[model samples]
Target: MLATTRNTLIQLAEIQHQLQTIHEFFNKWQTNPWGFKEEYLSEKVLVRFLKYETESFANREWEAHRKEIDLHIILQGSERIYLEDATKLTEGIYHEKEDYYLLEGPSNHFITLSSAIDQENSLFLWPTEAHKTGVNVTDEAVMVKKMVFKIKY
Candidate 1:
């Protein structure tokens, strides 16, 4: 997460530099069975493997950890992420087993993201942003590369 605009700019530049390295790594490992792994600028920046199954979606209840700036990079397949407006969120019965609270459905705002491999390297999500992920309509599974950073207010 970026603490300020300046930090966001810095992170963006560093991410751009790392994108070149990531592309090379992807070229080699895109078809590899072992997959790939790497560390970014610092421990605060991370690269990890992500897979989303077809017709599967994750309903999540998230609260701010300070503030968050997420860089979701798709490395393989495709999935739709449903985001709910924070202002519209209302408390629901806690399901301790799931480790997250459920929000009343019939959301007022949402967005769909398709395959974005050749277009851009990163997408940003802010704090208090309620999001439901892994909505895939395709038969093929989707792989994504994500870097989650904490933004200090």
Candidate 2:
């Protein structure tokens, strides 16, 4: 799923960083698994794998990026991702080299991401769109394996 209310330059970001390497991984995820390794697809594209159990909203933190557009692909299990506009959230300390800052606010909008549940199976989050991921979809916690493609813009 994609949210655009936070920033209208989302289209520009996508066009500049076409996400070509990400598509390659999409086709070879099963045949050529990269495991849980951090790989640099190119100078502009990067690959990261994460395995964790979904936790409560309060336990997680909201974050927004300034340099890259995040493409979250769920490989196994399910998670609820909450999104909020950065303009409305209170900003915390930012990691300069990392290009991200913590956000604190309420988010009433979200989507459930899972291999079996979502038809798209992937989600795109651009700059200024604060997101709190790894959220539990139900009452119980479930382990999720996800691949994140950081498309620099």
lDDT of 1 by residue, 1-153 (tens): 436688767756755644555455546555774544444534344455665454554443333222334546555555566676555767565544322355645453444555564544445665455666665535545554443333222
Backbone clash pairs for candidate 1 read 1-149, 1-150, 1-151, 77-143
lDDT of each: 0.50, 0.84
**What's the CA RMSD of model 1 in angstroms?**
6.7
lDDT (C-alpha) at residue 82 in model 2: 94
**TM-score for each candidate, following the candidate numbering:** 0.51, 0.87
| Residue pairs in clash, model 2 | none
Find the candidate with the highest lDDT and give its number. Answer: 2
lDDT of 2 by residue, 41-146 (tens): 7888888888999999999999999888898999889999999988899999889788789999998999889878535567888788899999998989999998
Once superposed on the true structure, which residue ranges of model 2 sit more than 4 Å away at CA?
1-17, 117-120
